[model samples]
Target chain A: MKNFGGHVLFLDRADINTDEIIPAKYLTEIAREALQPYLLESLTLDGFDPKRDIPGKQVVISRANFGCGSSREHAPWALEVNGIRLVIAESFARIFRQNMFNCGLLVVELPCDTIARLFTDYARGETFATADVARGVIQIRTGTKAEEISFRLSDFDRQLVEAGGWLEYADARY
Target chain B: MGQTVAEKIFETHVVDRPAEDVWVIRLDAVLCHEITTPTAILDLMRLGKDRVFDPSRIKAVIDHVTPAKDSNTATQGKVLREWARRHHITDFFDIGRNGVCHALFPEKGFIRPGYAVIMGDSHTCTDGAFGAFTPGVGTTDLAVGILKGVCAFRRPQTMKITLTGELPQGVFAKDVILSVIGRIGVDGATNRIVEFDGPVVQRMNMEARMTLCNMTVEAGGTCGICYADAITADYLWEHIRGEYPDKAAAAADFRKWWPDPDAVYEKTIVHDVSGLEPVTTFGQKPDNVRPVREMEGTPIDQVFIGSCTNGRMDDLRSAARVLAGRKVHPHVRGIVCPATTKIFSEALEEGLIRVFTDAGFCVTNPTCGPCLGMSTGVLAEGEVCASTSNRNFNDRMGRGGRVHLMSPATAAASAIAGHITNSELYKA
Candidate 1:
């Protein structure tokens, strides 16, 4: 997968579960493409409508336990289809993290302090950023001091995440 | 190091993989329902797979949108029915024969100890109560399993929860599990295999153990396991394999796979619930729970005592005992849905259905109604329901539908009181 970075959409909320990401009603739409417009519709963040606001943002940053409830793969599919390539959160729920990797989305978990700073920088009009998965750092574009925030990924996960997803990795291996 | 039951199961099933490494494991049983099977079928067809690898090992049930609420759900159900029939799947349960997938699968002897079970629904973890490692999967992975008979899984860390002390007379296993959720936050056990043990679990019946394991998904746990014992063997012989002596004899092998005495757990927790009260959820999350007595007089619009979680015969009996001589409140609507046709027939023979019917409850056929907001009893806007199902998330039942999760006894008592009340205050 190609490394990507752009203006990040900051949803300053804690414990945002999968229910907020994709509501139960929309799960009836079996196709992944049909569920895209309804992504995060239930999440009422200020100045952000997921259907309208997601086109320009390449990354989504959220608080701890970002995808917390329900093992619905549609949650990640909705985000991926709606043009979210990477997600940086303080932490992630296990199933959603797995779903993201399975559906070809890059998810990174950074320390809480650095995540808080990213949100603060966004508020202060520091919009541009770069996520270099190969370099293991997220660099700020417009900062007084050059900010290079490092993230963690195990060798096994790096190989899978860098290769697009689990299914592709599995296909390549077999 | 010694391993928990889940670790042991993975050790045996996962091919050439260490702990925490992804390994493709052969799935003993794969279940898909109407709402999910359609997509999985499409994916399978997209992969140019015309037939299921093992039709006998796959179970396709239509329980989510039974009787077809609308044309879309009807089409989906039809697609699944046609696919199952065309593929000659051995265990396909249609609407009349189907119930909630989690409850009916085990009752029909589809689940057994020491097996790797997977289903499209998130509550598939309910089968973990049978000492099997069951995890919920999405349609893609489910489709892959249907074609290949295997799915990739990483060995999860294990947690041991020891339930100490005997349950009080009025308390139930639902109360015990709700209390545990209150201790651990909603996402506290995410991706961890929660192994239930100790004195209380040993004494609980299969139904009670299922109740304990049913809500593990609410804690974001991968699976919840209780090692097979004499009770499990007796359950299989008497309940599951009735009139089939050979299956009962074969089921005796389940007892050999209990956790090692010194099993190494990532975390071990002990909960003492000897004097626990009947618990219920107050807010949106299931873990947002309180004692039913503490939340009395909290207004409710409906009471639903059915789902895979607490819709078994024992759950029905508990509700029946509470609503025997009582009438449902005028303002509240009460619904009693058995988990399966077998449960419905048993409740009918035992006069539990009569008790519910006499109390103004609308006893219905086996369907997962109002739980996922499909149909049959969908709540209206601003409606508050006291339900025995697992979740209480926002808009779970209907648009702006509020749910208070509770045990069957608490739900029955609340139906009578027109509020969230416990069975302890009810008089026979």
Candidate 2:
């Protein structure tokens, strides 16, 4: 997995659906790789920018039960294929989050301070350093001002986070 | 603190041992329909799989194509028919005996109280009417279940949905579910245990219970369950009376299939159905509801009479009753598609179909034809229709075919009225 030891970004309080991520008609076809373009179509209405870059400072922080309904695997597929760093929500749905883990995507839950730091740096495209996955503390350095964000990953999930996905972990296991 | 028998039965299935936060459980039954069955079976063949874990544990029925007119659906049906014969998979399939999978399962006793079941169709929540932990799964999940004999499940936060008092005249189970959908919008009950309670629920039959639980997918819940009682046991025993010797013994154990009175629930919702009428949803959402008495003169062009959600004997009979003597309006095109071949023949025997054909309505064979725009009945652009199927999201029935989801009775009334009208208007 590509390492982003000290980068952070944020998306606050948006509950996304698969229809918004990828419409129903698109699911009629068997091919899944072309799903990255339709993200937030139901919410954004017009469309989402496809050229948005995310090699670093990438994460989505949102409110409860993100990716709640519809067992469509495209929601996680679009996010993973488009290079989203991590989805740090208040919670996640069972099937959708599992799909994310299967595809080797990271979903982190961070304290409010860390969320704000991640949010600001991501929105402004300015660099914010949040390099503390161990010791349960996140340090976000936004230029001169630095904020400490709290976070933790369970041992089982840490392997997913480290290996970049469950399929990778399972592949390595075999 | 008043728990229904359905809640009690589920508690018995709860397997909360060490390190497991109740994420999965063993299944009592498994169901698959034609659309996904081809692939599920194909996957098994690809893996060189032979003989499922349990033949009696599985059931396959043709649903998507009944009035198999074209060579394609007929061929698809033939492939599945051969699979059933070779495997002896509790064959319930019939062109004549067929109905929508979700609607027929409980009618056939494939779903019952405390049963842990999984189905490939999204509408598997329909079985929850029998007080079972029934939910829909994708082909991958079903194939996985087909291979391993089990699948994972996350125990949901319990929701106590109490229906108070009696329903007003003409307001059936469809109205009750649509009312709940209206209150909760679409996503209100996601990942929660929706237990139907109160006096209205108590008085309801298993079919009515099935209707309420059938569309739980619209509200996005794990599944909806009614407490299994003497009523449930009696229905189950009576349906499979001649077939099984242990049927009586199973029915006698109703008390074994319910929740304890002191069961814990994550949330509770109460519905007072004191005054409601035949309701219908316009626009692109199922929760978009209005009383049938209210939809007078709302211009409609098409009326779809089929789908897994409302395709059954009773649903057809109810619609036929409303359309008996009346002629379908000149402007309104009434498209009637049966859920299965049995319902088609039964309707023909009853002369209910003659009533439809004489009234200038189009009677189609058993298929999801117009309902899903798969084949048969296709809708035109900018045309508004009153449909009996679930989900009116965008143009699901056809391209730009504005679908207004309603009960069969309501659709019948709308067909006669030349607009979205109440079935009560045509009665008597």
Candidate 3:
């Protein structure tokens, strides 16, 4: 059973694209660590500031269609380098969702109403979550409130996370 | 239990069932480009798994930041060049020959009906116009496709988009796709394969079909597919002639990839383009669409007419038609990049290049630059561009730059007007 989740960063907008995750200009760089400081650098959510908002957050809560536009693994690499491992959203672009799993990060797709509730209940507070892969539930808490939310990962996705990433899985199988 | 074209292709390519509803499918082609492939190549080397599964099945190109914007970009191109050579991949297209990968690969006739293709760039879905199961992947899956020739996916449900009625005189495939995206919203088709069908799609040539499928990703579609028809056969006849006796035979053979009449779709939507007008993106997202009429007179600093989406010969000809005698507005800078070296040569011979140059548009060699803001015509802060390329995401063209997506004709017209405007006013 692997552990997931941490401090939550709530991005309230939909269609948070790859360009926003890691701008196309930085994509010329070869190293993954080179992407660390630039995570969400171009995101233009109402009051979000990458320099102020991304430092210690280890999880992302966002609206629908997160990670849309341009299929770049650098998007996930940016998140990973920033020490974020879990993303909870109403939905995600197809390639971005798979890329997250390939990198051993988790993208939890909650229903629209559920995500709205999560934002209403926790977004303004200092939120933290503890995700249990084995039990398929996430324990979300703030200073004075706590809630349990369940998530399901496909068997292959769970295997990828347990193996650490696609590279490790390929090492064993291929 | 009839199957869609995507389902049939997946069935044919399946190598294993990794999990329930998850099938590991063998890839027929793995498309690679400088911007994304270098990281995959480096990772494979670090893991001591640098060998490709099949050298011949790989197609490599140096399209993004071509001629290299700086040493870092030069290194990225060099990495892909050396990797292709080391793997004995003969289909590598270097600086003088390279173009945008999505346009270049299909131009070489590498894609065919029923093929399963993957690339590291999102616009790779443009290849699905050939009636293939082509989808974009990330670097990790790209590395796996390169190394083992296999990638996994959950079975994608199909969403059928039936395009009815006729395309209006000034409305092109770019407008049609933009309209579709607007109707569906950005994530309307998430995790689904969109199968484009009906009379309008049937009438479109391969270039138009590619434009329709190219932006499917903007609507969150994994792949946008079209059924192979006589037009597809005619376009592919040069490369596929050896397999079939004649164009008719080739068309018939390719038709095997079409979905069965009883095939099920998760949902169906229809669009009638009889009164369709030129459209453009108003905001950062691709789905933030508006008719060119409403967005007209919105000032623009640049007009870019290129990218895999609309950089074909027809696109250039359309743009040239608008710019034939009119000079670009003094306040605006215009750039035109043909999609491929072949298209560039043809456009030169057709005098389209002269038309563009006469109009004060900087005619450049084929590169995906400026489309993603790497080079060629990057925008400065507070700048707005009327662009023919897809994806209007904020800062996509440059930091603090705004990109409004439209057709090449509209882009050219905007260059003349110095604002976001329709091409109808310029049409002969």
Name the top TM-score candidate: 3
Report residue A114 deviation for candidate 1 (angstroms).
2.5
Please tell me which model should have the higher DockQ, number 1 or number 3: 3
Evaluated with lDDT, which candidate comes out highest?
Answer: 3
Q: Write the per-residue lDDT of candidate 1 for residues B1-428, one digit (tens) a residue.
A: 77678777877887544124776788899898887678768766775665687989999888877777777788888888898889888699887788889889988878888989888777888888889999887766676677767777776788989999989877998899888988897877887889999999999999999999988878878878988876777767645455446654645667656787888888999999877888888877778989887888999999999998999999999999999989999999999999998999999999999999999999988988678777777889899999999888777788788998889998999999999987977857
- Rank order (by DockQ, best first): 3, 1, 2
Pairs in steric clash, model 1 = none
Q: lDDT per residue, candidate 2, A1-174, as tens digits?
A: 543343443444444544445544444333345565655444332233334533443555565556644555656666655556467766665556655654455666555564554565544555454434446455555566666666666655555556765434433432
Fnat scores for every prediction:
0.32, 0.04, 0.88
Kindly give the stretch of ten consecutive residues in candidate 2 chain B with the minimal lDDT sum: B15-24
What is candidate 2's local distance difference test score?
0.67
Candidate 2 i-RMS (Å)? 5.1
**Lowest lDDT 10-mer window, candidate 2 chain A?**
A41-50
Per-residue lDDT over B38-101 for candidate 2, one digit per residue giving the tens place of the 0 to 100 score = 5556656765764465778888887665656466566557766777777788655766677678
Task: Please compute and give the TM-score of the first chain of candidate 1 against the native first chain.
Answer: 0.88
How accurate locally is residue B25 in candidate 3, as Cα lDDT from 0 to 100?
A: 91
lDDT of each: 0.81, 0.67, 0.92
DockQ of all candidate complexes: 0.46, 0.16, 0.84
